[model samples]
Target: MASTVSIGNGYGQLLRTRGAWTYLLPGFAARQPFAMLTISIVLLVQHTTGSYGAAGAVAAVTGVSMALFAPWSGRLADRHGQRAVLIPGVLGHTASGLTLTALALAHAPLWALFAAAVPTGASVPHIGPMVRARWGVTLKGSPLLTTAAAFESVTDELTFVVGPLLATALCTTVNPAAGLVTEASLTLLGGLLFAARKSTQPPVAAAGHARVEHASALRVPGVRVLIVAFLGIGSVFGGMQVSLAAFTESLGEPGLNGVLYGTFAAGNMLSGLVCGALAWRTAPQQRLVVGYGALALTASGLWAAHSVLVLAGLGLLVGMCIAPALITGYTLVESLVPAGARTEAFTWLTGAVALGQAAAVTAAGQLEDHLWGGSGFLVPMGGTLLALATLLALRSRLAVRPRSRTVARGVGHRVPVAVD
Candidate 1:
């Protein structure tokens, strides 16, 4: 009973945190469309063009566009505020989605489809970083900030789990256009709702603020190393996705792809919540190292599994390390960068993940096409090994000694004064 009460208190703390749900819910909703967008585009383009090659090309372009533009959007939010950036970004993104859908329905030329995809991808609002920046501001200097980061990680897992399933269902049953249209509608509604919550938004730094011109977060001691580590981690996800699809197809149950993928995400979501609830004795950097090592170990299990059931079970096991790594990674970024550039720093992390996933997916697809079953799974295992190596080699740069209470208090009390 005592343990039960403690668990309940953890949840209570999450709920009572001011404006937590208000910012998080819409952020969660908005991210679903992004999660849905790539798969929907692939399905839609394939259905119309009858060419998986065409579909893959368009999806790759979309992914690249979003990865390139996300940091720019985040930089604008850091300067102009989330509301200023998100509203226009979301609107343009929605408009682009609509245009793409219209083109698809009208049987427009393949070149036209690719052209519309550029803006649709480029206009994504960087919702992940925006919500996280809000949490950083609201929960600064509090232990609960770790929990909040974990919550966001869980939201990411859930979005990936649900979004693809929903997109697949809509594309297969209703129509390909239906999936894209739903993504657009959700983006508009969720973006507007998220933008409307101005009170929780982080205060923007003035244009002329000296700190706004501070050296890029990439210049921070361990940030570049962290980014590289995250890129490898992202490849783990991308490779697993493609590997699972190939694995399921070999089982003659291609439709079960969503189920298998969701199972992986479910493991991530569950582990994130549990990891967040516990008090950690280790520092964030240490936890991050452990997470990477564990991921590599678990991912290697894929080599032993020949059947779908065994593969799915191993996926769940591998997923357990994902959230802990991501939560620690984001928390480390927060500690490394100045407050003025937090959003952009976070978005860079997001973009790195996207690019890594894109690269891995492309490579994994080729391997699956040429090699025997389960061989493609080696890619993620290799990625996790690379991540572990990078983290260990650069571990010294990520260290953060605990601050004295007096210094912590003094730093916490400083207000954001405008600079000329």
Candidate 2:
């Protein structure tokens, strides 16, 4: 067992790895667009069309397209390579995003906006999952794998904090379309830089590992459970995006939207850092359950928050609960799925989150338009409670499988299995 004192040393070891910064920095830049997209679409469409429902509908289309296609892209990355998949994806996303921005600003009909959104979203490179796959190969059997998951979760939260703040500021102060425009520019530049780092990319599954490569990652029982749980997390995110904006607008303090959301994301980042630094005696499955329960409880109070102060406090608490759950869930992925299928498995979870967020955005936007912002808050609490019940009922399905990785033998492949 590692002592608490090992926290700094643990992360330090990962930082000290040769060429780590090459991929890490560009990967960080490439992922900002995901955090920026939904809010940017929501803000811009709402500004141009004067309807939250329409804005959410457009954003939902984008989210759904991304959700449907992410796993396919991941499978291709596994079969071919990350560079091949990311190059065209990055180019297509940049072009499509620019088109969507133009259409929105021109007040083209809703159908045109939705049409442009499809390609805009579907081309989003699953950079975060690809980065995690790289980390998996780089540190295969080390205890630092768990630390790496925590580190990635922290990086995700940091992007959320910065992305929203930047997008919101650009939309509010510069131009309504500024957020999406800047997002496309970053995708082009950062994605190309990341793709050029060929040395760090995970090798394509060799022909000898064909059996493992051909099998779908979804065949694992645990991956399905994690996907559903991640969907609930996505609901919280999507619900909060629309609700917080509506609430702040109602108060004539629209700028607070970024501040409040940033507070929430900051909480997530802080807790992720703490999770990485600790050495735990309990299993990740247990931690996932407990963390989710806390998330559900904190989320329940959001609808009753009538003041900004109260809402911010509750948001921070809810955010804090998320990292432990996310970190543990990703940690479990390492054990439940085989090496060749890890990228696809990660994309499945990512896609599930996107799908859930799309649904929540549509539902919450309708509630905000017809009822009130408070009504939108109900979505997160309800989604989490229902998912928590499902999780409890299906908890047994999340048991970690025996550890296995495909190793190349002379003419074939064999998996060296280890007991967890």
Candidate 3:
């Protein structure tokens, strides 16, 4: 009871931090587009081109672009500042998103769509990672750092729950282009707003290090393992987005896609809240393995779900398994990498998920196109099992090194991390 009360108080204290709400609201809005992008692309492209394969391919292009470039953006932010990186990013993303929406609506060539998608994906502001970095800066030496991580994880899960449903509703009820239009508008407005709150932003990590050699976050062994594990989680997300859409469309109830997917995301949000509220006795490493094992077990049942009801139930179970792994993975980052490379480390993990989601979307789309929706479900099961095996084999790499430095304080302490 005391632990629970302290956890609750931790949240209360965090919210009470001066100027915290200023950036948090805008950050929340800016990051919603991340959740909306793939679904919006899948819906819009599939609507125009009439092929899930084409839709997936176009979306994959954007995902691949983002995955390739996000770390570079993070590195730049670490060297320069968040404002410098964000100004161009939000502007470019808005312009590119609008262009892609126009080309798709105009029935432009596949190459044209693919070309526009590059900048659209690459310029995503990564506001989640930025926000978490801000928390690290603000709560550097406080025990509230872990609480902040949990809060941010819950926020991210909430976005997943809301963003997709909003996009789906706009696409189905208003027009196919509405979702994309809103996404761009929100990106432009919210990104700028978040960027404007410069007070909360972390200072450039490289400011004092004149010509100092900075190491890449990729050099960390644990980061590589988490990236691979997150790839499996991404597969589930990508597979569910495409497969759920295809399944519902075949039933002649396309709107149900949002409802079912929302249910799945709701489970994720619920688990995040529960995970955050608990006073954990087990190590995050142990939690990670257990979480992933449950995820794989739940995913194995997806291929067997033929009805909407069955799929929703299995998806909820699958969703429930994700937060523990994700929360644990991000928490692991603090123990794994140095403070100077923290943003880049966060982005690398984010990029891995994007890359994995892109691959899974393409593969699942192909499977659904040539085979059946049931076959589409196979991708998640296969991807998770394969990645889970690698995680088991490489689990030793995730252990904390004896030489430690706290990311924010320069003192040695384990602070939990989270994403947008």
What C-alpha RMSD separates each model from the true structure? 5.1, 4.0, 4.5
Residues 1-420, model 2: lDDT tens digits: 334647679899988877889988988888987789999999999999999889999999998999899989988898889999999999999999999999999999999999999999899888989999999988988888988999999999999899999999999989999999999988898899999999999998677766656467776778888999998988988899999999999999888999999999999999999999998878778778888999999998999999999999999999998888889889988888777778988998888878888888888999999996678899899888887887888888788644545332324545442222
**Prediction 2 TM-score vs. true:** 0.95
| lDDT of residue 361 for candidate 1 | 63
How do the candidates rank by lDDT, highest first?
2, 3, 1
Question: How far does residue 145 in candidate 1 sit from its true spot (Å)?
Answer: 1.0
Query: Compared with the true structure, what per-residue lDDT tens digits does model 1 show for residues 339-391?
Result: 76678888888877776766666666667767777776887888889878888
> Between the candidate structures 1 and 3, which one is better when assessed by lDDT?
3
Per-candidate TM-scores read 0.87, 0.95, 0.94
1 against 3, candidate with superior TM-score: 3
Off by over 4 Å in 1: 1-5, 46-54, 102-112, 207-214, 373-375, 401-420
Candidate with more favorable, higher lDDT: 2 or 3:
2
Candidate 2 vs 3: which has more TM-score? 2
Clashes of each: 0, 0, 0
lDDT of 2: 0.88
lDDT of 3 at 357: 85
